[model samples]
Target: MSFTTAPSRWSDVWLVTAARGISSCGDFLAASALTLTLQSAGAGGLAVSGLLLAATLPLVALAPLTGRLADRVDSRTLLVLAGLAQAGICVALANTGGPTLMIVLVGLLAVGLAVTQPVLAALIPAMVRPADLARASALQQSAGTLGALAGPALAGVLVGSFGTRLPLLVDAASYLALVAAGLLIRTRRGGGRRPGPVATGAGIEARAWRLRRDPLLLATVIGVAGVVGAVGAINVVEVFFIRETLHSSTTTYGLVTAAWTLGMLAGAWIFARAVARLRRDGALAGAALALLGGCCLMVLVSAAVPSALLLVPIWVVGGLCNGGDNVFGNVLMARRVPEPVRGRAFAVYVGAVQGASMVGYLAGGLLLELLSPRPLVAGAGLAGLAAVAVLAVPLRRAARAERDVRPVSRDEPASAGEDAEPGAGLATPVPGR
Candidate 1:
């Protein structure tokens, strides 16, 4: 039993990072460019927001199928195909004259995104050393944040100066580059052994059924759902909190958002360095508390004080917690779920989080419409606090259980195949199923 050299491991990191960056760039551009394209095509307020809802729907509805596909086939190949599909949709969207056609194209693009994201996540464990999982997750988050910050601004400028259609073209081209980067990657397949008869097809169904019986997974979905909900609420109304609550203008709101983004970037870098000192659950618990505290501070400030001077610190702290929460959640998912079921497990995880987010945004908007910005902001904080309190007991139990569990050594060879062949095949094996 031997290990790969450090140089080989580093190459894998580069491959995964390249793939994520390219994909994030293309995704951001497609979504951003499409918004302007639709507006130009005579979309109204409700119609415009509906396009976003259309995009998010596939992520929730198609997750189980996409998750299964990620585990059952070549993840990199799937990622490449997803990118190509999205590129085609971007072209279709750019040329479309009707609102219906544009909406259809964006929906297809979203479907591609739903499939691509889980496959990209599943690929990380295959590419990096097990001990480096948290660091890898952090790097991925940082890359995504940087891509997101650059991508929309780039797309906006292109859309305004060149034309809305041109940004779509740029997005399509980035997907082409993403495909090329994926081709350059040469990581081991499936991350473990090929699935046995029981672990293959009906096996997938069984796993889904079995997940319903597991209290730990269920509790995790709930706790993480609340965190995601809090994020969604912030996304919808944080700008309003700055403008209305803090009495700042649009430019000031933009600066506050930028500060938040910077905070997230810094937090990711910090987590990559500090991950080794904390157990997986400890990391998640700490992140949850941080998020809870940040929201509490923001709400208190927005409701009681409402000062523009506090906006920078509030958004920065919240954004830092947001980034930490993402890294922690990804690591916990990778560590707790078995390798074979990881895709579906993550899919469920993704769906739960996203679904909760949608609800939170709606709740925030409704609350704001009915009451005031102060109450809405304070409510988010209260929700975060309640989530922490309710989930604390279960979280502790799960953490203890997970700590007692040990991972299979990389040196141990499975009987299904000689070794995991580099670059894709059947599903990986579950460590302790």
Candidate 2:
């Protein structure tokens, strides 16, 4: 489908999202396989969780620097490098039998994954017309969720028979394939990286660094942080909840995670449709309200101890909100931030998200260990609602500003044109799917 708000050449954008999905499937399969591998090797619950956390911590830690790097260099090259690194790490992980080696490999994998996200995010505007940002974001979000749903199931089968090494090998191949695909897709847009400060003599870099002070961006970070916190909390607690409350096994826990992915897929589809019709800002506000309601419902359900059918409803709500939120958030970021600093802005955004998630994971793990899963889950839901409530005013103001700017940007010429308006800068390129 074409959009007046999108570029004339949107087909390329779809290709990127599709490639992303393929890559995600491989990554997830590797992750699932790795988790199982550690479990089968007599890793304790804390150890398995610790391995997962270690892999993610690098992403959080390196996000700011990675973002800065993306702004200074070609995002596609970075993307290719990150993918290759992931492939290499998977290979290392596959060959290793020692838990220490496994942990180290996992940490490397996290660094690769962490660095790729911002670059990928910065690339969206380059692949599509500015007007189509919301649609593209929605599609990407859906692809990711769907990939998550399929990856684990595939990995489970592979690990059940061939053992974990095969899945890691497959993941490595997927990354190599992504690199090939990235190399084939060419664009005139410069990499999202900004020039270095002072010594580097890149005036552009200095200006971008200043954008870190933007109140709108700060608000976005705070809002996203809240959502990330809730997501992490659920991620940490859900398995334990299913195990303890529902008396489920590992397979069932995996299925529950898949259910969440299914919800996210459905949500992304719905959110994309909504954005195509209502525009991103309005659609986002509406979706946020719906999500907040769902969270409230979750709290009630937690108290009541609902049936299996009830669980489906909760999954649907969570998935829909999560998917919608992602699309909306990306649209906002793309629209609001200056293109020159997109890499750093996205990096900051990513770091904030990871930071929130880190806190959430640690807190959730501790809380779950000390208290009941019901309280943790319900508390997160309530906290999500409270977050939405707090951000309502600022979100409204930002949305108004975005709508005001959209028309002016639409009337301007493409950045490649000499006649391009003064404020009409080129979009940043990204490496992530």
Candidate 3:
């Protein structure tokens, strides 16, 4: 709350950032290794999709429970225990041989991720003041992007030399970083209330934050989910696209995919500098939409690249957009939502994204049987672009609504007709649910 706490907050940010980067590297290492193993075995797109589904379903299904748990339980406890469990699960996965068993283990790994995701997300806002939220989000995002950038390339090399099990082991080791971070992080969100825990008890009862309630957040979240859904199948199609369509080697696939993540790293910092200028939540939301659209445009353009080498530049462009989008979304959530309900908001957002990705995964598997990789990639791009176009109008309306209304302080009552969305209330408080 005070400038005195600034040093501590930045420290907390660094600790979280380091741990996140390492853990992300492990996750991607394991994933790329597994995908490589499956593809090299000629297991086909359905097999890959099934693998993806296993990893994703628990996040969507568990969002409600995990979100509440994030709010109700100690973050340190969750991170320490979840990280340890994930490490053990990865070890088991490495030793196991069967695809069915592998899928099951991956799902278990994701269970840890689901818990940690919201826990960390909610805690970041708690660590820093309002002015620093954008920078903190950028740091947090950059860590994840950097970790992701490292993971696949590591997997590519490790898998080629020592086989899949070694990369899996490395991933297992990465979980310990989360455990260390949990122990080291000074900031924690839990059953105990922090400063300004809830705006008003009556307001909490009448109008809890829900993703569907705010027009801007609702529209922003839905738009993001839509785009992810549109592009999700690209994950499934890409292995084949790189390996078969472009005749690239396995290592090439891993390295090239990482280029997007590298771009994401740069984009996070790049956008963070600009975020201060976009003070309004509406402006932030609009920026996110624009970035998402740019990402899709890059995807559409990638359809024509004749070689895998060419994908690096295209994906870099997309990755930059992706990273910027992430920063804006995080800033939007931290800016607009009250502190107490942030856990639920982030969980719901993550769930929406994973769920949309689930749909895309299934579609990709089915479509692979009917169409080749190039056309499928093109279609995915077009679908994502269309989602952006359709969502633009709602975003504009939300922006206009924001511009029209004078903002209210926490002690004041919200305007009666400020928002008409059902079950909606002000970020502070309002008369109606």
Cα TM-score of candidate 3: 0.89
TM-score leaderboard ranking? 3, 2, 1
Q: What C-alpha lDDT values do all the predictions have?
A: 0.57, 0.59, 0.76
lDDT comparing candidate 3 with the true structure? 0.76
Q: Quote the RMSD, in angstroms, for model 1.
A: 7.6
Backbone clash pairs for candidate 3 read none
Candidate closer to the true structure by lDDT (higher is better), 2 or 3: 3
Top of the candidates by TM-score? 3
Residue-level lDDT of model 1, residues 182-248, one tens digit each, is 6777764443444432232112333444455555556666676665565345444554565566776
What does the lDDT read for residue 181 in candidate 1?
57
Please write out the lDDT profile of model 3 over residues 1-433, one tens digit for every residue: 1112454388888999899889988988999999999988888889888999999898899999898888789999999999999999999999997888999999999999889988887787677654455456556666777788989888888988888999999999999999999999988887675445443211332136566557778888877888788878888888889889999887898888898887777776676566656656777788888888888788778889999999998888888777677767765665556666667777888888888889988898999988999999899888888988988888889778856874534443121112101111001000000
lDDT of 1: 0.57
- What lDDT is obtained when candidate 2 is compared to the true structure? 0.59
The model with the greatest lDDT is 3
Query: Model 3: how far is 424 from its true place, Å?
Result: 26
Error of 3 at 72 (Å): 0.7
